[model samples]
Target chain A: MSLLSLQSVTKTYGQGQAAFQALAGVDLAVEAGDFVAVMGPSGSGKSTVMNILGCLDTPSSGSYLFQDVHVENLDRNQRALLRRHYLGFVFQGFNLLARTSALENVELPLLYRGEPVAARHAAARAALEQVGLAGWETHNPAELSGGQQQRVAIARAIVTRPTVLLADEPTGNLDTRRSHEIMELLTRLNLELGITVLMVTHEPDMAAYARRVVHFVDGRVDSDQRNTPRETPA
Target chain B: MIWNTLLIALREIRRNLLRAFLTILGIVIGVLAVVTMVTLGNGATQAVSAQVASLGSNLLMVMPGQRLGPGRDSAGAPSFKLADAEAIRAQIPGLAGVAPMASSQVTVVAGGQNWSTTIQGSSRDWFHAGAWKLASGRLFNEGEERAGAAVCVVGERVRKELFGKQDPVGSQIRVKQFVCDVVGLLQAKGQSGMGRDQDDVVVMPLRTVQRRLTGSQDVAGLMISVRDGVSTSKVQQQLEGLLRERRHIADLEQDNFNVMDTRQIAETLSGTTQVLTALLGAVAAVSLLVGGIGIMNIMLVSVTERTREIGIRLAIGALEQEVLLQFLIEAVVLSSLGGLIGILLATGLSMVLADLMQVPYAFDPGINLLAFGFSAAIGVIFGYFPARRAARLDPIEALRHE
Candidate 1:
């Protein structure tokens, strides 16, 4: 059984006349440590698939197996537990709580887990340092530049040391140089921490950082291919 | 988890201090108004009770005609005589004492100092019926009462005004057309329930005022005291019947005289004040509901404002209840803080108002605690809908919200 797999997954939105199908029987699978970049146009089923994989939304029909467990059968709270224990998400907008210090923002997940104050503080500090924000713990998101804010967002995501790191256009808001830097950090985390990385990006340059790239067209996987050089250039 | 949620709530409130304060302003004012009205009302009731208690134990006052109103107060009713008081003493059983009294406003002069005061005329039983005690000197003898003696007892206020600190006993005071010898000084009985000063009067034998002051042989009122362990009501019923027969009232006609039960008057007065207090308190409580609505309004706005933030949290794997608790606790903290401040302000305000209104400052812990608990309850009640809205958001749609 793969670490995460979706077989014949389909999703529908609205009802009756407004009922629009976003996913049309897509099949995908990932091993524990693989880095896959999902590529598609705006209307393709990439985002719908990502939402299903992240457990934020349920598929209308199909079997979503996380470690061979049927994620589709899990209730909202159970899916939340799965996401809590195993998934980390990074967004393009870099959503950080406003008027809050980086350390406290990073501590949010640990807080939900009912960790003690001392443990949450220590773990949050370590995560901040890991994201190259060691001395920026006291600074709020407003005080940080866009790249720094994204780093804080990444730190918050990985604070729980999740099994799967999902990035949704992680560097879409950044310039080329900053985007390259963020891609490198994600690649390093996949290689060193052995965390599975699933990302959706429109940019080919960012997708090049992934080991495999899956292309979606009209809500189905059109092409899936491995890069020629599996190792990222230093 | 609750503690963490509470901390998060506090942080959120602190982040928007002015908005939070304004949100809870309604609660503070409601609690303040409620506590103030109830506290002051209780104080006034206590003052009334205390004043009436000082009149005498188991005492009843009988005046000619009905009580004070548009059509009554001794109008067109033949007044009592000294004989009526004698008849009550002779006929009534379980009687303690009966004193027939007549009074007129008079100006008196002593040692060249003049003061206007009320002059009361009654037999020696007046002292016994009222349970009055002398600060100095003695009551007049029976012979003096029969011969219409010019000897009198002065109250503290009259003594103070007429002779300063000097001993009024053995001194002479001129009242109307005759000079009377001051024989005793009565101890002060401060203010009465009617807000009249009880210590601003002079008392003399009933015949002296009838002859020398008013030139009438009529008595204006009767003060009757019942002995301990005796039913004042039963005695009151018999007295009413006897007065009706003596005054020649037929079976269907209302009696010319009205009797005032001190105990009944105390209850009625306090009952009226309590009703007023309850009314004001209930009105104030409605404002508390309004305050809760204010909290709900702000919380709804907050949930909408933080839609993206909630989406981020949900995306990061926070449970739905966690989000709900954060907002719920935020509202609870705001209103509870308001309750605390309101309690403090109410205490200070009621103390000042009580003094200005001449009532005792009554601090009620039960009310303060109830207000606090109620405000917290209001938070839970009003905060739920908004918190639920925040918790039940579609993470994807919420993330897309601007």
Candidate 2:
């Protein structure tokens, strides 16, 4: 069975004359350990798809199944539990808590999971190390550079060992070199840990790192293609 | 969950210490006003009661004329004579003592020091009726009281004013035109229930006062003490009837004399102070409501400012209740801290003010705890709306907030 399946999912805002549809009957499926990049222009509903897939939003119509559990029927709290156990998110803004240290930000998910202090500490430290920030655990987001802050955000996203890592334009704020570095980190996480990755991007170079690219236009998929993923330049 | 929320709250408060203090300022002032007013008022009531009690328990005072409104009668009522005191002492049952008293303001001089003080004259029974203790020397003998001896006792304040630290028992002091020997010194009784100094007087035999000062064979009032377990109201009734009959009041006429019970006076005076205390407390409590509004105001601001942070928390698997709990705990901590600081401030201020006002220091634990608990309740009552607002934010829209 596929790890995630969305069939004819639609999301609309407002009502009647003011109603706006962000997504209109989109179908997608992700197998385990897949690295898929979703590409589109602005207002093309790429972010909407990411939101629905991350369980931060539900479809106005149709079915969403995660491990065959029918996620579309879950209530708010149940969706939260699903997200807590199975998903991780990295944002374009590098949304690390402003005044909090890197290690504490990474430990946030495990804290919500009610992990014991010692175990959470060990897990968060390891996740930071995985993102190449071992000795920078004590630095706050404000004290770190933009690229380093994004690393902390990724560390926080992966600390829970989520089955699927959702990156919503994660490298949209970085320079070329830093963007390549982040793409390399995401690629390594997907290949080494067998974690599924579903990313949204506007940049073709970033999309090239994924094994599959799905192009969205006007709330519908324009093209879906498979390619040999490019290895990171050392 | 509660522990985690509390931790987050403390961290937030520490982050913006000034804002937190300013947010809770209203609560601090509210609690301080309530506690200080109540505590000082309690001390005043206790002082009033203590002074009234020192006048003697189960005692009654019979004064000429009715105590009308704020003024005494314009037509003078007939005064009591020595014979009336003898009649009450001889005829009444359950009676401890009866003494007719008359007083005048006089300047007394001794050893080149002159001081103006009240001079009261009565029989030896006056001391027993007033429960007055003598510090030195002796009260006048029966012969002196009967013969109208020129002997007197000075109160503590009088002694201090005229003689400094020297003993005045053997000294002679001139009262108006009469030269009198200081036979004894009365112990200090501090202030009266009316806030008048009780120990600024001299005492002599009633005959001496009537003959040498006023030159009339009449007394101003009668002090009557009843034995323990005797009902003061019952004695008051008997005294009223006897004095009315003696003064020739008809059946239709109001009694020419008024009977005042000291115990009832104490209760009435203390009750008035208590009511005033409660009024002050209630007025102070209004400020606490204002304080709660302040908390709500600041919490709303906090929710708006942290909109994006809340969105992140929600997206990262924080339950709605968790967000609500976080903001709610922040408000509670702020108000509770205000309560704690208010208590400490009130305690210190109350002690200092009570001392300056010459009243006892009365610490009521119940009022302190009540103020504390009420402040915390204010936080919950006012904090809920903002906290719920924070919890109900749309995660997608919130993340889009600038």
Candidate 3:
């Protein structure tokens, strides 16, 4: 069974004459240990799909299953619990809590999970180290460069050891060098930990890092293809 | 869970310390006003009761003419004489003492100093009836009272004014034209319930007051002290009947004499103080409501100011209740801090004002606890709306907020 599946998902905003459909009759499946990149123009509804996949929103009409459980049928709190245990999200803005240290930011998910202090500390520290921020635990988002801040956001996302990592333009605010560095880190996480990743990006070069790419046009999938992943520069 | 929420709340408060302090300022002033007014008012009530008790706990005063209110007396009421006091002492059962009293304001000269003070005349039983204690010397003997000798007992204020630090006992002070020897010194009694100076007079034989001072045989009033365990109301009723019969008032006529119970006076005075205290407290409580609104105002601003942060929290699997609790706890912390500081401020302020106002310092734990609890409740009452608003925000829309 696929790790995550969405069948005929349709999302609409407003009503009657003013109605706008962001996603219509879209079907997608993500299996375990897969790295898929979703790419599209600004108004092609890729962000809406990402929001639904991250469990931050529910499809207006669709059947969504995660690990055989109906995602569309879950209430708000239940969806929160699912996201807590099985999913992690990285945002385009590198959404680390301002004025908070990197370690505390990473520990937020575990804090909500009600983990013991010592265990949460240990997990958060290890996640930060995995993102090459071992000695920067106490640095706040304002004090860090864009690349370092994005690394902290990634550490926060994976602190819970979620089954899937969702990145929405994770390096959108960084320069080319930092963006390459983030892509390499993401690829390494997917290959070494066998964690599935679903990323949304507008950069073709960034999409080249994914083993499978899906292009969204209007509100439906225009093309889906597979390719050999590009090698990272030493 | 609670610990985590508290930590987050404290962190949020620390982030904007000035704003937090400003937010709780209303609560602080509200609690302070309520506590200070109540505490000082309690002290004043206690002082009034104590002064009344000092006038003799079971004492009764028979005054000519009915007292309509404070300072308003009925006209054409006949004065009591020595015979009236003698009759009450003979007829009344369970009586401690009864003394006929007459008083006049006169100038008394001693050594090189002359002081104008109230001069009172009564029998030796006056000491017992009025609960007067002697600080020095002794009361007049029966021979002196019966002969109407030129002997007097000086009160503390009279001695201080006319004799300075010198002993006034055995010293001759000229009262108007008569040279009277000071036989005793009365103890200080401070102020009376009516705020009059109690220790500012001279006491002498009633006969001397009637013949030498006023040249009249009538006494102004009678002071009666009841024995222990005797009901004052019962004695009052018996005195009313006996005086009415003695004065020969008709069955339908209003009695010319008024009987005043000291205990009743104490209760009435203290009751007035308590009502005033409650009024001031109610007025102060309005500020607490204003403080609650202040909390709501700041919390609403805080929710809006931290929208992106809230979005991040929501995206990271924080339950709606968690976000709600975080903001709610922040508000509660702010207002409770205000309450605690207000309590401390009131304690210090009440003590200082009580000393200045010449009343006892009374610390009532119940009022303090109530004010503190009420301030916290104000926080919760006003904090919930903003918290609910923050929790119900859509994560996607919130993240997009600039």
Task: Using TM-score, give the best candidate's number.
Answer: 2
> What ranking of all candidate models by DockQ puts the best one first?
3, 1, 2
For each candidate, what's the DockQ?
Answer: 0.57, 0.52, 0.57
lDDT of 3 by residue, B273-374 (tens): 888778877876776667667766766666665777778888889888888888778777887888888898989999999999999999988888887788
**Candidate 3 C-alpha error for residue B180, in Å:** 4.4
User: What ordering of candidates by lDDT runs from best to worst?
Assistant: 3, 2, 1
TM-score of chain B of each: 0.84, 0.91, 0.90
lDDT of each: 0.85, 0.86, 0.87
lDDT tens string, model 1, A1-234? 799999999999999999999999999998899999999999898988898899888899989999989998987678877878899888889888888899989998888778899999999999998888899999999999888999998898899999999888999899999898888889988988898999999999989989899999988999999974245665
lDDT of 2: 0.86
All candidates: CA RMSD (Å) = 3.9, 3.1, 3.7
User: What residue runs in model 1 are displaced by over 4 Å at the alpha carbon?
Assistant: A115-118, A175-177, A222-234, B1-28, B67-75, B105-117, B131-188, B200-205, B211-215, B306-309, B323-370, B397-402
Model 3, A132-177: lDDT tens per residue? 9999999988999999999999999999999999999998999999
TM-score quality measure for candidate 2: 0.90
User: Which pairs, if any, clash in model 1?
Assistant: none
Residues B1-402 of candidate 2 have per-residue lDDT tens digits of 777666666766776677688767767777787788889989999999888888887888888888645666727788888889988988778988888999999899998999999999998989998889999999988999999899999999999999998889999999877799999999989888777788999999999999999899999999899999988888887888888788888999877778888887888888888898889788877876676677667656666557777788878888888877877787777878888998999999999999999999899998888877887777666666755765676666667777
